[model samples]
Target: MAKPTPLNLLADLAQNDTEAATRELGRLQGLRTQAEQQLAALNKYREEYRARMQAMAQDGMTATRWQDYAQFLTSLDGAIRQQGQALAQAEAALLTGRANWQSQKRRQNSFDTLVARAEAREQAAGARREQRANDEYAARLARAASHRQD
Candidate 1:
């Protein structure tokens, strides 16, 4: 990738600090995906349960079968709650990873700014040195001409 911005120079160093954080974020995202998949499966199970319950009711099932249906509904409710908790945890992990990445970026930016400033200062100093040498050379040239005249 072409680095169009001045900040691109800091990419490598910043990546080192953020590497673990980035992995963590990816992990979090994967967990979220898994949770969603499980949630989908649970939804399918709920539909199946409803269908079975309906079939039992139509077939004039005994009171015991109705009790079993109630128990199944309660279990499904608990599973849904658990899936919600998992989603919350995954979201929290993603947030943590984002915070870490931002911190790393800030540190890298500070270092890049310092380096640029130091390079600017060095260039200024070199220019001053060159100017002084040129002044001294001019004075020497003037003296040589004056001596020749004498």
Candidate 2:
């Protein structure tokens, strides 16, 4: 048998598993990053809005205008709270995804190690067989020379 080793199971199965997990991890990272950026943008806008309101209040704002600003700030707070929850969920999902990828990678590495060891053993055995054949040929030549001398 020329290609005797059936050592591609890891590439077929374990590698696929690891690759899928890696992709999942990447998606989760993107989601988490997006959530964080959105939250930061919302917070920054809220800060700027508040500063504007303060300046208007200093210029003697109308009561209706102040009430409108207060209502909008309340809505903004709700949006911020929802965004915070979304970010938390994204963070949790990313953590789980990372763990899954690490586990899959570990399994793939273990299988790769086993395959490497098996190949090494096969190579060593082949070397031993070659050495034996060489030794046998040398012995035969030496015996032939001895017979000739006798």
Winner by lDDT: 2
What is the alpha-carbon lDDT for the whole of candidate 2? 0.92
- lDDT score, residue 9, model 1? 55
Per-residue lDDT tens digits of candidate 1, residues 1-150?
Answer: 333344545655676777766777788789888988898888889989989899979989889989999898889979988997887887787788788877987887776676667677778988999999999999999999999999
After TM-score superposition, the amount by which residue 110's alpha carbon in candidate 1 deviates from its true location, in angstroms, is: 1.9
lDDT of 2 by residue, 1-150 (tens): 225446656545888999999999999999999999999999999999999999999999999999999999999999999999999999999999999999999998988787878878889999999999999999999999999999
| Model 2 misplaced regions, further than 4 Å | 1-4
Give the clash total for candidate 2: 0
- Clashes found in each candidate (C-alpha, N, C closer than 3 A): 0, 0
* TM-score of each model, paired residue for residue: 0.70, 0.88
Residue 129, candidate 2: C-alpha displacement in angstroms = 0.9
In model 2, the clashing pairs are none
